[model samples]
Target: MSEPWTLHPDRALPADPATRDLAREIYAATKDLPLVSMHGHVPVEWFAQDTSFGDPAQLFVVPDHYLTRMLVSQGETLPRLGVGSTADEAVETDPREIWRRFCAGWKHFRGTPTRYWLEHELVEIFGVTQRPSAETADAIYDQVAARIAEPDFRPRALLDRFRIEVIATTDPAWATLDDHAKLAADGYGERVLPTFRPDPLLHPDRPTWREDLERLAAASGVDVSSYDGYLEALRTQRERFVAAGARATDHGHLFADTTPLDDAEARRVFDAALAGTVTAAEAQAFSGHMLFQMAAMSAEDGLVMQLHPGVLRDHASAPFAAFGPDKGYDIPVVTEFTRSLRPVLDAFGHHPRFRMIAFTVDEDVYSRELAPLAGVYPALRLGAPWWFLDAPDAMRRFREAATETAGFSNMSGFVDDTRAFCSIPARHDLARRVDAGYLARLVAEHRLDLDEALDTAVDLAYRLPLAAYERR
Candidate 1:
């Protein structure tokens, strides 16, 4: 009989006998490093409530788009997997049923990072001894459910147990941040910080732009009737986030363009958008201009700017309408940065206090655009493989493509960029192992000494994120 699934200690390392031995040492050195999840979408409400994760499906399947998207590709219905239910689609209410569906589709996640993270969570975190499948679904669910029911498995307790040194939660520009304030009062604010996300405020083409602008006014106590007032309102709200221990601002625009329009053009577009008469071209230009404006704000306030463009949110409309945003349909579009970001980089690339971390799902830009840019700029750093490129082979490919031009210092280490809270350590672990494997090749090739490789591994695993994010 075959044995139940288990995670190998040397998983994700190099394959060669000699290089694999070197990778094992490097991985061992950095495997237990404290995770600094500087960029993620984990909800702040988790810590504020300190509640137990409800069940196995709620904790693992329902909230993880990575899992849901894969299961969806395998012909499973979205609502049946416990996603949002509309009048047209009835969501499954039984957590056990959702678990069964996910287990049955487990084979679909192979060759995906989703599989690796889930396996780590099951074997290392939850102590599950059986492989997930139709036959073992109930047994594994029972194991995970009972484990989370423990007092130490509450959200706050998991933070300590996971050794997550710091985590940043993405919050909208208009959020009241009362939850973050509550976290501060409890002395957990600095450990769990907020990241300012102003995508709605910048994109005039969005249907909710006007409503979100009013929300920014309400939050900032500024009159956002004029373009100047709108900019001031954004700045004031960023101050609120900074006061709450924010160290970065996150932007996910569709395009990487950052050319700024003149004052008159800016006002014209703003006026058109306010009247709901802005054309798609004008809105695209204005969004790019707003990105430049954001860079200017970061330059002044010292908030580390994180820009990840080239994603078409909600690629499939039917599922999106039924389940809403983040339903696992955001697809990557080809993106360019060299010319698109010239305006922002030209203004602040050499600024002493200015910093920006550039991320992309478009891996083609790593060697062609991002690495070459970061190689020279004093203020820019290349972010790790993000979103679609966060898999093991893609990550290794990124190192091979970018490290030659940008080297290790010009990178921002790794950001999990996850919405699932339990996978924080697992994601970081996967990254560490991949980095170790890459660095082992260098040591074996005599490009770097073993001690030097170990130091770089620690930097990639721990130190670099702190510096890239301006974590003092």
Candidate 2:
């Protein structure tokens, strides 16, 4: 007989008895604090429409790149996992088969954060008792499907159940934010907000740059034919996003370079990009210049600037061509921030209205570069371990590396940059546990008092994100 699944009460606490007790105490104190999800990729339409989730497979497997990426790595095809190339493409028709495949590959996720979150969802959220395996797949799927079909399992109900105080969804530069408007009409405006993500508009080398510019023009009612006009349109859109309750703007650039250029040069590059004659070097320079310009806008408008660079997005072209972007192929390249950001830091590092949160997939920069930069710059703050580095060990390492230089106040608390709505609480719970344990270690070593550690735990879990994102 297979062993029954259970989540230990002290799952991520320290092994040392005294420290474990301390960690448990700290975790218990902050475990139920309302979640402040300042940044994420959850679609706003679900909350606006208060839709019911379809099935276990759709909830657990279909939308999560973390799970699908690992499954694809183990030689399972995306189509077999119900991931279609396009919206119209036919994917795996049977959700039961998809669940079976996921169960068969379950062992592969052992020791992964994805496994931790999935197990938490299955056991704590859905009350699944059997460990996922090929033998238990059908029974578990039927159980989860039955639960999802109930009225209580709808998205809005889950949001309240999860105690999500606020969740900011990433939206395109040209997005109308109609769903957000609907939520406001329904009186959920403060709870669900839009975040302006203008990556497609910033990169001139993209094949769709001109098309994106036209869309921005239409959205902002400002002609983006010239470089100045492009800036005006971006500013207009940022104001619109602010009106829609956005507290920050998110950028996922190739690097953190923020050197500015003269208007003539910027205009030249902009015209070249529009005419489809811009070189790769010119595109890079223009992107860097635009980064500085974005900071300028943020300083003027008080929108917190979130800069997370270093990912080489769409690492594999085949998957990107077959499916659209964000199919989990983005790989991290080495990133530097200290020197690359000096130009912008020199300009607005002390600007009163500016607040910049820097995130990296490259952890080496945590202690060496990012920490020291955020330590001194009044405008700069270190975003919590992001993307590939938001796991148990990585979270601990981030605290160790960043705390000494930047200190706790300079750090942005956990953001749960996730597309999987069900995983939000699990992810935040993991963060709270990891932080509790980290703080417990500090107490055990006589670096901090128990009361201070408890306060820090609550800050990391709840207050820091709101302050960092300027959510008030």
Candidate 3:
């Protein structure tokens, strides 16, 4: 007989029973609250078309780098899991075979959060009580495929079922937002929104920097060759995103360096950036200026700004060369936030209307840099542990590090930041559990009261993210 597969009763709870009880209470209170995902990478067209999901493999396996990356590490090729190849000839031949291969490799995720989430999806979402294996693969696949074909399995339906109050999608500045416009026209405006992500346009060091700039110019119908023209183009595009129900601007830079360059210096760097000859320092300066400019735009437009820094995207050159960005090659690098953000903080950190949520890949800076800054700066808030650090351990560490100094108000609850649509509820569940456990520890240690713990738990689970990213 197969080993009895079950999620632990004490999942994400503290080891101590008393703490576990408190954590359980905290989790139970906020577990059913509506999910407010303020930031993510889900395509807007999914809701725009309100289309039915194709298959289990396509819906669950193909688009998620988290699952595919692990499978690839185990020598399972991406093609076997239905990850489409850039080369036209290499697409997976059969979806059923991909499902079988994925099931065969499911054991690799044992004891992982991904494993827990997949199991939850199988059990709770698909009602598949049996464990996934070579034997159960086809049965589970057929069940999910049929379920997805039902009317209630549509994207909007799933959103409503997931108790998601609102979800925001990240898009480039050049994005037409046609799908977002369609969603608003269809009267789903209050449910789904766009976020302005200016990385490709702002990062002068990006591979296709010049081409991207020209594309931005064409998309916005504003000449980008001149500095003044570029500002007009960015303003026009930001207004377009704002009109389409966007509430925030996302900036993912290598670091958090925000200093304004003098016009002459800025113009020189802009010229070099357009010519694709800017140095790393010049690129950094240009990005910094753009961030300050974006902040000014946010102040005017009431769009919250989210600064997610310290991600070394495409750490491996070979896979990036073969597959391009976000093929699970990104790695976290050590980041200096106190000094790096000083320039920006000096300018707008105290502004009443200016709001920025700071996310870090460098965990070491949580207590030392991020907490102290957010504790004092009116404009700053700490984003939840993101990407590499969104796991159970990291979540606990973040609370332990940041809660005392910055407290619950200075933290922006939890944002899943996942492309795996099915994992959304599971990811948020894990966060709620981890936070409950963290607060439970505080209560056990006499650091906080039970009632206050309950309040903090609810804030961490429900209120803070919306307050951080919602329209001002």
C-alpha positional error of residue 197 in candidate 3 after TM-score superposition, expressed in Å = 0.7
**What is candidate 2's lDDT per residue for 1-472, written digit by digit as tens?**
7577899998877888999999999999999999999989999888988877888889899888899999999998788899874444558979999999999999999999999999999999999999999999999999999999999988888889999999999999999989999999988999999999999999999988889999999999998888889999999999999999999999999999999999999999999998899999999999999999999999988999999999998898877888778764999999999889999899999999999999999999999999999999999999988789988999999999989999998988988999899999999999999999999999999999999999999888988998898842
For model 2, state the Cα shift of residue 351 in Å.
0.7
TM-score for each predicted model, relative to the true structure: 0.98, 0.98, 0.95
> Model 3, 1-472: lDDT tens per residue?
7665566767778888888888899889888999999989888888999898888888888887778888888998765677656453376868788888889889998867788789878877888867888988898899999999999999999998899999999898899888888888888998899999889878788888778888789889999888889889999999988888888999888878777888889888888887778999888888988888888888788889999988888887766776777864687778888887787788878777789899998889999999999999999999999887888888888888988899889999999898778889998989988988988888899999999989988898889988998677
Q: Mind sharing the TM-score for model 2?
A: 0.98
Q: Rate the local accuracy (lDDT) of all candidates.
A: 0.92, 0.92, 0.86
- Give the candidate number with the greatest TM-score: 1
Error of 1 at 346 (Å): 0.5
> How much does each candidate deviate from the true structure in C-alpha RMSD?
1.1, 1.6, 1.9
Scored against the true structure, residue 415 in model 2 reaches a CA lDDT of 89
TM-score of 3: 0.95
Q: Model 3: which ten-residue window has the lowest total lDDT?
A: 80-89
Report residue 21 deviation for candidate 3 (angstroms): 1.9
Q: Which stretches of candidate 2 lie over 4 Å from their true place?
A: 1-3, 85-90
Winner of 1 and 3 under TM-score: 1
